[model samples]
Target: MGSGSAKTYRLAFNGTAGQYFGIWATNVALTILTLGIWSAWAKVRTKRYFLGNTTLD
Candidate 1:
């Protein structure tokens, strides 16, 4: 690679639908049970799930 060459990276998501469904279901159930109070935690959980399953190469 040349010094001035631009670096390229590929962003990939490796999360399966089943895995996400489980998270989504739990978040939904908890959010409803807590009267929307769990939404903040659910957002964090969802973000972590996606970020954890993503890769850069």
Candidate 2:
């Protein structure tokens, strides 16, 4: 890197509270109904929502 205008990396979170709540609620319900058996899938979906919304700018 030179002393000139250096490159910069920015990270952003674009997830809204409502969107996250919806996903979280769905996961909770499914997990409960399945007697915690669906918890793994629910956790995956929850993680995916956050990961997908995270952006690099």
Candidate 3:
């Protein structure tokens, strides 16, 4: 009895929530200091950090 259905699997990962708070705090400080350009830097930094910390299987 095989009905075609999409089966999905998820990967398990663990990351530091504390570090995210720190990242946000630092981003705010840098943006205030650099006058908005640091916003882009912060976005890229956050993206890379998330991507690097993510795992796929």
Candidate 4:
């Protein structure tokens, strides 16, 4: 009976899987090149990338 009064929400992904893969690959390469020293920065970047692209409605 209240169906018409219900609100609808949508969630979306602003980032593509390919883009994430590229970023992941690059980070892995750089981390290895630096002998794992770049891992910390890579982790931060990876987390930021996902968080930035995630959206709620």
Q: Residue 40 error for model 1, in Å?
A: 0.5
Model 2 misplaced regions, further than 4 Å: 1-6
By how many angstroms RMSD does model 2 differ from the true structure?
2.0
How far does residue 4 in candidate 4 sit from its true spot (Å)? 16
TM-score of each: 0.89, 0.81, 0.75, 0.75
- Give a tens-digit lDDT track for model 2, residues 1-57: 577997799999999999999988988998899899989998899899989999988
In candidate 1, how many Å is residue 53 off? 0.4
Q: Rate the local accuracy (lDDT) of all candidates.
A: 0.98, 0.91, 0.87, 0.92
lDDT of 1: 0.98
What ranges in model 3 sit over 4 Å off? Answer: 1-7
TM value for model 3: 0.75
lDDT of 4: 0.92
TM-score ranking of the models? 1, 2, 3, 4
Residues 1-57 of candidate 4: C-alpha lDDT, one tens digit per residue: 565777788887799989999999999999999999999999999999988998889
Q: Indicate which candidate wins on lDDT.
A: 1
Backbone steric clashes in candidate 4, count: 0
